[model samples]
Target chain A: MSSDKNNINLKLKVWRQKNSQTEGAFETLDAKNVSPDASFLEMLDAVNEDLIKKDKEPIVFDHDCREGICGSCGFMINGEAHGPQKGTTVCQLHMRHFNDGEELVLEPWRATAFPVIKDLMCDRSALDRIIRAGGYISVNTGNAQDANNIPIPKPDADEAFMSATCIGCGACVASCKNASAALFTSAKITHLALLPQGRVEQDQRALDMVAQMDAEGFGACTTTGACSAACPKEISLINIAKMNREYLRASVLKKEELSGGGDG
Target chain B: MLNFLKSTVGRKYIMGITGLVWMGFILGHMAGNMLIFLGPEAFNSYGHSIVSNKILLYGTEIALILAIIGHVTSAISLTLENRAAKGTRYAVMPKGEKASTWASRNMGAQGSAILAFIILHLITFKYGAHYETTVNGVVMRDLHKLVLEVFMKPGYVAWYVVCLLLLLFHLSHGAHSVFQSFGILERKMQAPLKKIAWAYAAVVAGGFLSQPIYVFLVNR
Candidate 1:
């Protein structure tokens, strides 16, 4: 729909909430004569600037680096996570994607684990808690080891690198019909489990992270596959399968250890 | 070990394993059902042979019952937890963004239909009239006559066909998903598994559906 026109006038329907306790609703406003080259966040900034000029509270949303690298900013644009484009985060979405006079809808991630904090921002600390459960390695770090001290196979390293690319963005959870965090949780598990350095605690890491994920009140993954489809990093759903393998193995081993082979 | 059952992944693993058990049962059941094509002598003899072995028949029946219980319980709990996870609903839901199948989304509804069908089927066939038929000068339960009598009625035939169709939808999703849930299927195997699932669903449904249609055509 991009043409000779340099600017597109749009109608924005943004979700606004006072806090988690209060009810929320959509606030429709005019986004007039916006430059097509502006990023989606910049367009929101323009709208907020106008609200401020009219003696109204500017729209509140979470955004750190307007760049797509940081996982700080994410909200549903229309019905799709991070807007209509595939593998494009909201921060990287350009206004040129929309046509003139098109009505755009925006809302925060709607999951029990993520409660609304303000207008377009929701509390995503639930993800942080899952990571804290065991998303790290416990190696001693007095001094940096030589680069080639521990050899990693290319395939394992590649797969591990892919899994590690997860930005902790809540898009997978938002896009899933079940609001499942399986993709996010599995990404962490698979990333660590694949590396030699992270292998020492792989069993415990899978167990604790999955236990923490369930405790966080997230839903079970039914393999609907929307999470991987909507993932900005294109995180594979295979990771979830790998995570399941890890959890099952660790659980049986732990049970054997606990019962001292009596159960067997 | 009990704590594992409480976790979401663990519950799904149970569902997967139990679903596989059910699939195996369906395959065996379908194979046994094919004896109807061999006429009354073979069909009745097959029925006689199954009922004659009391321990093997009862043991298999008990195992099937346990599998059903496990599958149904995990399904109900998982569905409730999934609903709770989605705290709020979107005002406008746009469709066709993803490649999700119709069967995958409505698994609960399809499963409920299958459950209802199973109850009705058991009452109609297993506990139907106790008529006796002489095969090779030996009296046995007339299961072949019962099947012919049931299939002759248009209403019963329609119901059976409808149930088989529901089963097709259920198996179309269940077969592939069970392997994925158990974490055994690899990335490269997904496409082939999906194809195999569709083929299995078609074959099972087709085999079961042919009986009533064949009986109706011959008797009419």
Candidate 2:
């Protein structure tokens, strides 16, 4: 809609917070003379430059590898996780997608598991802890195996690849009404469970990761499909179904087969 | 298994299993209620057959009661935990996926209301005034008379109307949610599964809904 305009000047209502310990509020600011081709984060950078020139503390947000691969740089833009564009991260969103003079509301992910570290920046370490608890396969170190060694089926490989694409951006958590980390946890579970190398510890992996996810105070999965719909990677809801199946296996698994956890 | 049930995923399995059980009961009950349109003979006979076999009737009753208990306990536990998990509400969070938020988001309120309705429903119908009737030289509960009498009251019909609506609202999400909880809802099956859930919910709830209005209006 803004293709006709060389630049779009917009109003921004950004969430400002000192830290998780304190209260947060919305701070209204203006972004003027912005190029339509500029990414969403670039517009923020421009606004930050202006704030610096005015001797004010600029807005704090998380971002790395502006290429959209770093699993960083995500905040709610008008309640839509990673902005309104489907399957595109905020870092990849251009200003042209938004109308000129539109009011852009920016806030960090809202969840007990993702506490605010600062303005538009939340601590997503809970996701890391889920991985640490057991998001791994039993791979021996040293020599690399050829990709064709496993002789995996094409569909399985494709599904595994899709599940592996989850960037851990917390968009799923932000989008879910319950703020359940089911999508994030399930994606890792699916990615690891599908491959042969990870199959050995699959039961324990599901158990530990899901237990850790619950321990993090994240909500339960209602299977509303919101997380999958809002996912930037388009992670399928099947991962969650797979996660459920894996957990079912854990319940039936004998004590000898279960090694407790994948903490090692 | 105890440790597994303690986990969120395990609790959901409980929710799913009980949910399906309720679905089956709802289907059978709604179908049997349709005999009301077939007159007292058919309705009374069906009721007679149900209570005639003490073991079967009591078994079904116990099973249904257990399903309700399982469904309620797990739902309450999950809801409380979910509430606490969302530490704070967002100042500007807009509604996401309208189709989802409507039923899924309101499941707690709707479920609680439905539970209350179930309690009152049992008292009114199961333990309602016992009227006797003889058909084919066999004594039976005049449930048809009780049904007709209750529906004739405007307030009772209105209550049924309201409760049926809540049932539909709750069923819309729940019908589909069962598949997800059981790990059966694959990507290819998502659309069909959702459609089946809606159709099933509508049929069961709608079937129950038609009775009160029919009884009240037809008799009047």
Candidate 3:
């Protein structure tokens, strides 16, 4: 143990893959005298810096907006999504959480739908496909409305806002055993379905988006609660139950066009 | 509707509903079988009442078979789908107290074992040996003798108990999972309902388990 706790050396077991088409393997690297306050990604950058000086290929990972709002930079750390700290993204995680000398394992998200593009970076565009299906309100204009114009119940607003917190990170898929995207899809569904502004195409939104999710080849939800626990934003599982209700309602009832309230 | 029927959520609904059907029948069957503890006369008459009406008997049998078909078909389809969805697993997996339970993870295996047991059960008692007896001036199938004979065999009794344990495992996860698939749970009700479902599973499975051991011991 150093008398001055300014610097700590650690071992990292990082996954290394050339590209999406190639096989990947783990490589052990030394991270020497790293600052305790450095973020996890910063530590990775330090290691990459050393690798470059040694004439080795620098480790490649996805990262942006180190503040954790960008929804980028997530991978399994010691088999845990976004590392051991609860509800914290890798960019927000600090080196002080680890032991003076610890070995960490990092891997990309695993799912048939999410193919690994490289070490610690998998293709999450399947999530984009789901949003493209029906993740928006039918707005006449993109401009903001007067905040007081619409009277939304406090509970409903809370529900919608809670669901809206999902940053589209793929940690839920990374943590799930079945690799289901129920949490992510449900959050999107609930984010729109709970507000009057989004009520117009609510039924259609549920149907098309869920269908798109299935088409992406994600597994059926096992309701294991791992996704909620692993979520960096702490999204609730109720969003999933609500989404199921919406899908069922849209499938069973809810005529496509109401076109009503008239005497012909 | 067809799209709903074919979706992953749709299959889950089918599995949950059909599973409920079987759970209802299990409770009824266990209660009816307990008539043996009353006496052969009581047991034989109870069996007679069920089989005397051909329409009702056939109707129950048909519904039960249909439930089995739906449950098993959806189960197999979901199993194949889940296998494909897992893709390539991580070399390093989360250890210690995972979010998935043994029952939730191995529902396919538990359900398959229960299905196999059901077939063997029907053969042993329902179609095994039919003895006739006149009770209260009405002749009826001597189901009591068949049940006693079946339970008297230690091998059959052991197999039956193990299957009941498997049923416990299947129901422990499935009963509460139905609420999730059907979207009938309130946020506050999830935990309490889960506990209630586990209790229900234990009671039904334990009830069935009690009968065979009791009969086997008496026969010995």
Candidate 4:
């Protein structure tokens, strides 16, 4: 572990709110000197401790795994989402990237659907709702097939992985002035639908997910590409274009019967 | 208008229009206020006349408020459509950093900053002692005196300068954005549009900043 000698002090202007119903405002705090090697979450932990020591409510934010694998922890750093580091998750971000005495403004993701649950914590479950609408493939439970039963080309698999890497963090939604999620949804749809196995329920998946995404009251994508820039996972706007194509295909084909006539 | 509102790009066009309209308002307001540095009596009467004309001022205020709300709503609606269009996600997105302006991407943030400043300014000056106040039977709105009281404060001048900076950035991107959203901006028009946007931004931003600098330095 790196020593604390390299740590720098920071001032944080964090937005605090009790819930979605209440109005929130920025509250400034002095972050004590801390290690530059500490993960972003660890730095938050340090700040939270100070708040607790003063008997004030610790800032409420979300984080599942500090390892950057779970796609939970996300908040604005200064004006940039996930800090100034490109292609880096918040939890993986280290203090060394920031200058000493800099004023960091932290806020929950700004989107209509993802309202602030509290300080730094936003209700991003709207994304999960969108996924649940039609993000899955229809497969049988009892089938144990050989790996050779389904042949996936290396390039296709790589593409699938590329699209599948979307953590669904809502950074795309947050960064967008319009708060659109087409990139995130299309990424999931294209990742699976591109493969032979996914083709079975591709049409249904596109229709259902897009319908749900709309019902969630999320805004439309204007192809501004801000979402991609702010995304911690760097999900591409190409996925959004793919989703548009898929939605058009599904809408036009109007196929009533899903593969195997089973609900996904 | 209804037909235009029905389409995808149409709604964005509306947003761009409303946004540009608000930007126009900002430019006009800044230009009008900068006359304060011309000397207290000159700036004072202008402020007084504006306040006295309840019909014009209130009408403009209502329109400004509506434009702001429309811009915000359109922005929200467009974002949702973009998200819904993406079927799945990719690890690499298009290179957005180099393509769009800083103001375009940070519209929401900039809007928030501007809104906060407006509220502060309204409370501190517009509705405060700077305006025509009543003491007994006397109508006491000293326009020149109010100008000095507000701008002579280094803090207020500094804050005004910051607001103008935000306005400048907003106009620079917003001017071109309106035309693009309308689909009126073609490859042939790009060069001219770029020049126009820069000039527009410079005039508005420069005009507004001139007020504070004049007051803080010359007037003081």
Candidate 2 structure quality by residue, lDDT tens digits, A1-264: 234447888999999999989999999999998888899999999999999999998999999988888789898888888888878788998888988799999989999989899999999999999999999876668999887888878898999999999999998888877789999999999998898988888888888999999999999988787788778899989899999988898778735625567546
Give the number of the best model, judged by TM-score: 2
In model 3, the fraction of reference contacts reproduced equals: 0.57
Tens-digit lDDT string for candidate 4 (A83-187) = 778887799999889888988888777777787788888888888987788788767799688988888999788878988888888777766555666678878
Candidate 1 Cα misplacement greater than 4 A, ranges:
A1-6, A255-264, B97-99
Task: Estimate TM-scores for all models.
Answer: 0.94, 0.96, 0.93, 0.58
For every candidate, what share of the true interface contacts is present? 0.68, 0.73, 0.57, 0.12
After best superposition, candidate 3 residue A32: deviation in angstroms? 3.4
Docking tier of model 4: it is incorrect
Scored against the true structure, residue B113 in model 1 reaches a CA lDDT of 89
- RMSD of every candidate to native, in Å, equals 3.6, 2.4, 3.1, 13.5
Interface RMSD of each: 1.5, 1.7, 1.5, 9.5
Better of 1 and 4 by DockQ: 1
Q: Rank the candidates by TM-score, best first.
A: 2, 1, 3, 4
Comparison by DockQ, 1 against 3, better one: 1
Q: Compared with the true structure, what per-residue lDDT tens digits does model 3 show for residues A155-188?
A: 9999899999999998888888878888999999
**Could you tell me the fnat of model 4?**
0.12
Misplaced by over 4 Å in model 2 are: A1-5, A254-264, B95-99
